[model samples]
Target: MKIERTQTGVRMEKRLLKVLKALAEHQDRTLGDLLEGIVLHAFEGRAAFGDETLQVIRQLKAVYGLELTARDSHRLEEAGDDR
Candidate 1:
Protein backbone atom coordinates (compact mmCIF):
# COMPACT_ATOMS: atom_id res chain seq x y z
CA MET A 1 0.00 0.00 0.00
CA LYS A 2 1.10 3.52 -0.75
CA ILE A 3 0.19 6.72 1.01
CA GLU A 4 0.15 10.14 -0.47
CA ARG A 5 1.53 13.09 1.48
CA THR A 6 1.46 16.83 1.05
CA GLN A 7 4.08 19.16 2.41
CA THR A 8 2.70 21.57 4.98
CA GLY A 9 4.16 24.57 6.64
CA VAL A 10 4.09 24.71 10.42
CA ARG A 11 5.80 26.31 13.36
CA MET A 12 6.72 24.68 16.66
CA GLU A 13 8.97 24.99 19.69
CA LYS A 14 12.52 24.67 18.36
CA ARG A 15 13.72 22.23 20.98
CA LEU A 16 10.67 20.05 20.54
CA LEU A 17 11.16 20.00 16.78
CA LYS A 18 14.81 19.07 17.19
CA VAL A 19 13.92 16.20 19.50
CA LEU A 20 11.31 14.89 17.10
CA LYS A 21 13.76 14.89 14.20
CA ALA A 22 16.33 13.11 16.30
CA LEU A 23 13.77 10.52 17.31
CA ALA A 24 12.84 9.97 13.68
CA GLU A 25 16.46 9.24 12.83
CA HIS A 26 16.83 7.07 15.89
CA GLN A 27 13.99 4.86 14.73
CA ASP A 28 15.39 4.68 11.20
CA ARG A 29 12.27 6.40 9.90
CA THR A 30 11.46 9.57 8.11
CA LEU A 31 10.31 12.52 10.23
CA GLY A 32 6.93 12.66 8.50
CA ASP A 33 6.31 8.95 8.99
CA LEU A 34 7.32 9.07 12.65
CA LEU A 35 5.09 12.06 13.33
CA GLU A 36 2.18 10.49 11.50
CA GLY A 37 2.48 7.30 13.51
CA ILE A 38 2.69 9.25 16.74
CA VAL A 39 -0.33 11.40 15.91
CA LEU A 40 -2.39 8.44 14.77
CA HIS A 41 -1.50 6.49 17.91
CA ALA A 42 -2.44 9.45 20.07
CA PHE A 43 -5.74 9.73 18.25
CA GLU A 44 -6.42 6.13 19.17
CA GLY A 45 -5.37 6.69 22.82
CA ARG A 46 -2.33 4.45 22.55
CA ALA A 47 1.32 4.97 23.34
CA ALA A 48 3.34 5.86 20.24
CA PHE A 49 6.27 3.56 21.08
CA GLY A 50 7.58 1.37 23.88
CA ASP A 51 10.44 1.33 26.40
CA GLU A 52 12.93 0.15 23.80
CA THR A 53 12.12 3.14 21.62
CA LEU A 54 12.56 5.42 24.61
CA GLN A 55 16.03 3.99 25.25
CA VAL A 56 16.94 4.65 21.63
CA ILE A 57 15.56 8.17 21.88
CA ARG A 58 17.80 8.83 24.86
CA GLN A 59 20.88 7.69 22.96
CA LEU A 60 19.94 9.55 19.79
CA LYS A 61 19.25 12.74 21.72
CA ALA A 62 22.94 12.91 22.57
CA VAL A 63 23.96 12.01 19.04
CA TYR A 64 21.70 14.68 17.55
CA GLY A 65 22.47 17.31 20.19
CA LEU A 66 19.00 17.38 21.78
CA GLU A 67 20.45 17.17 25.26
CA LEU A 68 18.16 19.52 27.15
CA THR A 69 17.37 17.85 30.46
CA ALA A 70 14.03 18.41 32.21
CA ARG A 71 15.74 20.46 34.89
CA ASP A 72 17.51 22.54 32.28
CA SER A 73 14.26 23.13 30.48
CA HIS A 74 12.60 24.17 33.72
CA ARG A 75 15.43 26.56 34.55
CA LEU A 76 15.25 28.10 31.09
CA GLU A 77 11.51 28.56 31.38
CA GLU A 78 11.86 30.07 34.83
CA ALA A 79 14.44 32.50 33.49
CA GLY A 80 12.23 33.29 30.45
CA ASP A 81 14.94 32.26 28.04
CA ASP A 82 15.82 29.77 25.32
CA ARG A 83 19.20 27.99 25.06
Candidate 2:
Protein backbone atom coordinates (compact mmCIF):
# COMPACT_ATOMS: atom_id res chain seq x y z
CA MET A 1 0.00 0.00 0.00
CA LYS A 2 1.16 3.50 -0.74
CA ILE A 3 0.95 6.10 2.00
CA GLU A 4 1.35 9.85 1.78
CA ARG A 5 3.97 11.49 3.95
CA THR A 6 4.53 15.02 5.07
CA GLN A 7 7.36 17.01 6.59
CA THR A 8 6.74 18.02 10.18
CA GLY A 9 8.51 20.29 12.62
CA VAL A 10 8.16 18.56 15.96
CA ARG A 11 10.02 19.39 19.12
CA MET A 12 11.42 16.70 21.39
CA GLU A 13 13.78 16.32 24.29
CA LYS A 14 17.45 16.66 23.35
CA ARG A 15 18.83 13.46 24.81
CA LEU A 16 15.87 11.46 23.52
CA LEU A 17 16.50 12.79 20.03
CA LYS A 18 20.12 11.67 20.22
CA VAL A 19 19.07 8.20 21.27
CA LEU A 20 16.50 8.01 18.47
CA LYS A 21 19.01 9.15 15.85
CA ALA A 22 21.53 6.59 17.03
CA LEU A 23 18.90 3.87 17.01
CA ALA A 24 17.84 4.80 13.48
CA GLU A 25 21.47 4.63 12.34
CA HIS A 26 21.95 1.32 14.08
CA GLN A 27 18.90 -0.06 12.28
CA ASP A 28 20.11 1.39 8.97
CA ARG A 29 16.90 3.39 8.44
CA THR A 30 16.13 7.07 8.08
CA LEU A 31 15.07 8.80 11.29
CA GLY A 32 11.66 9.63 9.83
CA ASP A 33 11.11 6.05 8.78
CA LEU A 34 11.92 4.80 12.22
CA LEU A 35 9.58 7.31 13.80
CA GLU A 36 6.76 6.32 11.45
CA GLY A 37 7.10 2.66 12.37
CA ILE A 38 7.14 3.44 16.05
CA VAL A 39 4.07 5.63 15.84
CA LEU A 40 2.16 3.12 13.77
CA HIS A 41 2.86 0.37 16.25
CA ALA A 42 1.81 2.62 19.12
CA PHE A 43 -1.46 3.39 17.35
CA GLU A 44 -2.19 -0.33 17.27
CA GLY A 45 -1.37 -0.75 20.97
CA ARG A 46 1.57 -2.95 20.16
CA ALA A 47 5.17 -3.06 21.25
CA ALA A 48 7.41 -1.58 18.61
CA PHE A 49 10.81 -3.01 19.57
CA GLY A 50 11.44 -6.63 20.45
CA ASP A 51 13.96 -7.85 22.99
CA GLU A 52 17.07 -7.43 20.87
CA THR A 53 15.96 -4.06 19.57
CA LEU A 54 15.02 -3.04 23.09
CA GLN A 55 18.48 -3.95 24.31
CA VAL A 56 19.99 -1.79 21.62
CA ILE A 57 17.63 1.02 22.61
CA ARG A 58 18.71 0.65 26.25
CA GLN A 59 22.34 1.00 25.25
CA LEU A 60 21.56 3.97 23.06
CA LYS A 61 19.62 5.63 25.85
CA ALA A 62 22.51 5.12 28.23
CA VAL A 63 25.02 6.45 25.74
CA TYR A 64 22.88 9.53 25.15
CA GLY A 65 21.95 10.01 28.83
CA LEU A 66 18.20 9.83 28.20
CA GLU A 67 16.80 9.64 31.72
CA LEU A 68 13.22 10.36 30.80
CA THR A 69 10.77 7.48 30.84
CA ALA A 70 7.15 6.91 29.83
CA ARG A 71 6.22 8.26 33.25
CA ASP A 72 7.70 11.59 32.28
CA SER A 73 5.61 12.02 29.20
CA HIS A 74 3.58 15.28 28.99
CA ARG A 75 5.20 16.50 32.20
CA LEU A 76 8.38 17.94 30.81
CA GLU A 77 9.35 21.53 31.48
CA GLU A 78 11.34 23.70 29.14
CA ALA A 79 14.90 24.47 30.15
CA GLY A 80 14.26 28.09 31.08
CA ASP A 81 10.67 27.98 32.27
CA ASP A 82 10.27 30.23 35.34
CA ARG A 83 6.97 28.65 36.24
Candidate 3:
Protein backbone atom coordinates (compact mmCIF):
# COMPACT_ATOMS: atom_id res chain seq x y z
CA MET A 1 0.00 0.00 0.00
CA LYS A 2 1.16 3.49 -0.80
CA ILE A 3 0.82 6.13 1.86
CA GLU A 4 1.21 9.87 1.55
CA ARG A 5 3.61 11.63 3.85
CA THR A 6 3.69 15.16 5.21
CA GLN A 7 6.51 17.21 6.59
CA THR A 8 6.11 18.84 9.98
CA GLY A 9 8.20 20.02 12.85
CA VAL A 10 8.43 17.45 15.62
CA ARG A 11 10.40 18.16 18.75
CA MET A 12 12.17 15.37 20.56
CA GLU A 13 14.79 15.02 23.25
CA LYS A 14 18.31 15.47 21.85
CA ARG A 15 19.86 12.20 22.95
CA LEU A 16 16.79 10.15 22.01
CA LEU A 17 16.71 11.71 18.55
CA LYS A 18 20.37 10.86 18.07
CA VAL A 19 19.73 7.22 18.96
CA LEU A 20 16.72 7.00 16.65
CA LYS A 21 18.65 8.50 13.75
CA ALA A 22 21.56 6.13 14.30
CA LEU A 23 19.24 3.13 14.45
CA ALA A 24 17.54 4.16 11.23
CA GLU A 25 20.92 4.51 9.55
CA HIS A 26 22.04 1.13 10.86
CA GLN A 27 18.95 -0.48 9.31
CA ASP A 28 19.39 1.45 6.06
CA ARG A 29 16.09 3.30 6.44
CA THR A 30 15.08 6.92 6.65
CA LEU A 31 14.27 8.26 10.10
CA GLY A 32 10.74 9.04 8.97
CA ASP A 33 10.30 5.53 7.62
CA LEU A 34 11.47 4.02 10.88
CA LEU A 35 9.17 6.22 12.94
CA GLU A 36 6.22 5.38 10.71
CA GLY A 37 6.82 1.67 11.06
CA ILE A 38 7.14 1.95 14.81
CA VAL A 39 3.94 3.96 15.15
CA LEU A 40 2.03 1.58 12.88
CA HIS A 41 3.14 -1.36 14.96
CA ALA A 42 2.23 0.40 18.18
CA PHE A 43 -1.22 1.18 16.85
CA GLU A 44 -1.79 -2.53 16.45
CA GLY A 45 -0.44 -3.31 19.93
CA ARG A 46 2.49 -5.16 18.42
CA ALA A 47 6.12 -5.13 19.31
CA ALA A 48 8.10 -3.20 16.72
CA PHE A 49 11.45 -4.92 17.21
CA GLY A 50 12.73 -8.38 17.92
CA ASP A 51 15.57 -9.44 20.20
CA GLU A 52 18.35 -8.62 17.75
CA THR A 53 16.93 -5.25 16.87
CA LEU A 54 16.38 -4.57 20.57
CA GLN A 55 20.02 -5.38 21.24
CA VAL A 56 21.05 -2.91 18.60
CA ILE A 57 18.70 -0.32 20.12
CA ARG A 58 20.27 -0.91 23.52
CA GLN A 59 23.74 -0.32 22.15
CA LEU A 60 22.63 2.79 20.33
CA LYS A 61 20.91 4.11 23.45
CA ALA A 62 24.04 3.54 25.47
CA VAL A 63 26.18 5.29 22.88
CA TYR A 64 23.79 8.24 22.76
CA GLY A 65 23.10 8.27 26.51
CA LEU A 66 19.32 7.97 26.13
CA GLU A 67 18.21 6.62 29.49
CA LEU A 68 14.51 7.31 29.14
CA THR A 69 12.17 4.34 29.30
CA ALA A 70 8.52 3.49 28.78
CA ARG A 71 7.91 4.46 32.38
CA ASP A 72 8.93 7.98 31.52
CA SER A 73 6.28 8.33 28.88
CA HIS A 74 3.73 11.12 29.53
CA ARG A 75 6.04 12.38 32.27
CA LEU A 76 8.54 14.36 30.27
CA GLU A 77 9.02 18.08 30.85
CA GLU A 78 10.69 20.52 28.50
CA ALA A 79 14.27 21.52 29.31
CA GLY A 80 13.34 24.99 30.51
CA ASP A 81 9.99 24.10 32.01
CA ASP A 82 10.00 24.33 35.78
CA ARG A 83 6.58 22.73 36.23
Candidate 4:
Protein backbone atom coordinates (compact mmCIF):
# COMPACT_ATOMS: atom_id res chain seq x y z
CA MET A 1 0.00 0.00 0.00
CA LYS A 2 1.12 3.52 -0.70
CA ILE A 3 1.26 6.03 2.13
CA GLU A 4 0.77 9.78 1.94
CA ARG A 5 1.50 12.38 4.54
CA THR A 6 -0.54 15.35 5.69
CA GLN A 7 -0.39 17.74 8.57
CA THR A 8 -3.24 18.01 11.03
CA GLY A 9 -3.81 18.29 14.72
CA VAL A 10 -6.53 17.24 17.10
CA ARG A 11 -7.04 17.74 20.83
CA MET A 12 -8.37 14.72 22.71
CA GLU A 13 -8.35 13.59 26.30
CA LYS A 14 -5.56 11.36 27.54
CA ARG A 15 -7.95 8.48 28.23
CA LEU A 16 -9.28 8.63 24.70
CA LEU A 17 -5.75 8.65 23.35
CA LYS A 18 -4.99 5.54 25.37
CA VAL A 19 -8.08 3.83 24.01
CA LEU A 20 -7.16 4.74 20.46
CA LYS A 21 -3.65 3.50 20.93
CA ALA A 22 -4.90 0.17 22.31
CA LEU A 23 -7.32 -0.28 19.44
CA ALA A 24 -4.67 0.58 16.87
CA GLU A 25 -2.22 -1.92 18.32
CA HIS A 26 -4.86 -4.63 18.54
CA GLN A 27 -5.85 -4.07 14.93
CA ASP A 28 -2.20 -3.80 13.82
CA ARG A 29 -2.91 -0.49 12.11
CA THR A 30 -1.60 3.00 12.56
CA LEU A 31 -3.69 5.49 14.53
CA GLY A 32 -3.79 7.74 11.50
CA ASP A 33 -5.36 4.96 9.42
CA LEU A 34 -8.08 4.32 11.99
CA LEU A 35 -8.93 7.99 12.39
CA GLU A 36 -9.05 8.52 8.62
CA GLY A 37 -11.45 5.61 8.27
CA ILE A 38 -13.72 7.02 10.97
CA VAL A 39 -13.75 10.52 9.49
CA LEU A 40 -14.35 9.25 5.95
CA HIS A 41 -17.23 7.06 7.11
CA ALA A 42 -18.89 10.01 8.83
CA PHE A 43 -18.73 12.06 5.62
CA GLU A 44 -19.74 9.28 3.22
CA GLY A 45 -23.51 9.63 2.97
CA ARG A 46 -25.37 12.93 3.01
CA ALA A 47 -24.26 16.48 2.50
CA ALA A 48 -26.55 17.91 5.14
CA PHE A 49 -29.65 17.20 7.23
CA GLY A 50 -32.99 18.80 6.59
CA ASP A 51 -34.85 20.95 9.09
CA GLU A 52 -37.17 18.06 10.00
CA THR A 53 -34.26 15.84 10.89
CA LEU A 54 -32.66 18.55 12.98
CA GLN A 55 -35.95 19.17 14.76
CA VAL A 56 -36.36 15.48 15.56
CA ILE A 57 -32.93 15.25 17.14
CA ARG A 58 -33.56 18.36 19.19
CA GLN A 59 -36.97 17.10 20.32
CA LEU A 60 -35.57 13.72 21.32
CA LYS A 61 -32.80 15.35 23.31
CA ALA A 62 -35.36 17.52 25.06
CA VAL A 63 -37.67 14.56 25.79
CA TYR A 64 -34.79 12.70 27.38
CA GLY A 65 -33.86 15.72 29.49
CA LEU A 66 -30.56 15.97 27.69
CA GLU A 67 -29.02 19.40 27.75
CA LEU A 68 -26.48 20.77 25.33
CA THR A 69 -24.56 23.93 26.01
CA ALA A 70 -25.44 26.97 23.92
CA ARG A 71 -22.28 26.53 21.87
CA ASP A 72 -22.93 22.86 21.25
CA SER A 73 -26.51 23.61 20.19
CA HIS A 74 -25.27 26.22 17.76
CA ARG A 75 -22.65 23.88 16.40
CA LEU A 76 -25.28 21.21 15.77
CA GLU A 77 -27.45 23.74 14.00
CA GLU A 78 -24.50 24.78 11.87
CA ALA A 79 -23.60 21.16 11.08
CA GLY A 80 -27.09 20.58 9.69
CA ASP A 81 -26.56 23.42 7.25
CA ASP A 82 -23.03 22.49 6.25
CA ARG A 83 -22.70 20.81 2.88
In TM-score terms, which candidate is top? Answer: 3
Q: How many pairs collide in each candidate, listed in order?
A: 0, 0, 0, 0
State the lDDT of candidate 1 residue by residue for 1-83, as single tens digits: 79899998886557668878878876798989999999999899999989999887777677656767757754544345555
The residue pairs found clashing in candidate 3 are none
Top lDDT prediction, candidate number = 3
Model 2: lDDT equals 0.94
lDDT of 4 at 38: 59
lDDT score for candidate 4 against the true structure? 0.59
lDDT string for model 2 (1-83, tens) is: 99898999999899999999999999999999999999999999999999999999999988988889999997999999988
Q: In angstroms, how far off is 23's CA in candidate 2?
A: 0.5
Q: What lDDT score goes with residue 28 in model 4?
A: 83
Task: Name the weakest run of 10 consecutive residues (lDDT summed) in model 2.
Answer: 58-67
Work out candidate 2's RMSD over C-alphas: 1.0
lDDT of each: 0.78, 0.94, 0.95, 0.59
Summarize candidate 3's per-residue lDDT along 12-33 as a digit string, tens digits: 9999999999999999999999
Instruction: In model 1, state the lDDT of residue 75.
Output: 53
lDDT of 4 by residue, 1-83 (tens): 69788978876544445655555565587998867765776698643335774565455555545565536643544334555
Instruction: Assess the local accuracy of residue 27 in candidate 3 as a C-alpha lDDT between 0 and 100.
Output: 97
Q: In model 4, how large is the Cα lDDT of residue 66?
A: 52
